[model samples]
Target: MNRVEIDGDRCKACGLCIDACNKHLLTLSSDLNAKGYHPIEIHDVEECSACALCGVICPEGSLAVYKEIKPKKGG
Candidate 1:
């Protein structure tokens, strides 16, 4: 499984990540952050491909993508 962690306090709500996401899983939050900007939120984490495009596109560096690693069965 893959996941995206967003730092709302650092996010500027520029919408660049939203445009960069191919899965359309990212969206702006209804609540405002300390910076008075609607932070980005993931609609469906399971749909994320962990392509890192959103994180790469974000100027604020608020988004972090992590890919889960599973051990081999007979290792």
Candidate 2:
């Protein structure tokens, strides 16, 4: 499964990642982080392609996307 990991403390609630995500997988949390800012989270995670657009758009560099890779049957 593909997913995004966010360092809430490092996030500034910019919402850039939310806009960058083509799959609409990002959303702002109602609660604030340690920095007193609302952080982004992966909400619609059913089909995350791990495009890294969110990470790229994140100015704070707090987002990391991970995608699971399947091994080949003949390998």
Candidate 3:
């Protein structure tokens, strides 16, 4: 499973990460963060493809995804 961490304090709620998530796993939270902006929330961690598009698209770089590496077959 991939681990996605969202720093609410730094998030500007630009919704870039939400749209960048290919898995449709990201959404803007209804609750406000310390900066008074809605933070991005990850739906299912198990469903995360670890594509890292959200992290890359984030203008604030508030999202970080950590993916487990699997050994390639027939290596």
Candidate 4:
């Protein structure tokens, strides 16, 4: 499983993540953050494929991706 984390303070509400995400898993928040910008958020984590497109397109580099490694058999 993979998770997408966005830093509200670092986000500039550019909506780049939303556009980069082909799965439509990410969306811009309607409410403004402390920086007065609508930060990006994942609407559905389950639908995310960890494509890393959002992270790549983010100009501020506020996005971080954490991928969970699956346990190997007979470890």
Candidate 3 lDDT for residue 32: 94
Best by lDDT: 1
Score residue 73 of candidate 1 by CA lDDT: 93
TM-score of 3: 0.88
Off by over 4 Å in 3: 71-75
TM-score of each: 0.91, 0.90, 0.88, 0.86
What total of clashing residue pairs does each candidate reach? 0, 0, 0, 0
Residue 21 alpha-carbon offset, candidate 1, angstroms: 0.4
The digit string of per-residue lDDT tens for model 4 on 1-75 reads: 789888888998888788899998887888798889988888778777777899999999998887777899899
Worst 10 residues of 2 by lDDT: 38-47
List CA RMSD, all candidates. Answer: 1.1, 1.2, 1.9, 1.4
lDDT (tens digit, per residue) of candidate 2 on 1-75: 887888999999989988899989888899899989988878768689999999998899998889889787997
Quote the positional error of residue 58 for candidate 3 in Å.
0.4
Candidate 2 Cα outliers beyond 4 Å, as residue runs: none
- lDDT: which is higher, 1 or 3? 1
**Backbone collision tally, model 2:** 0
Clashing pairs in 1: none
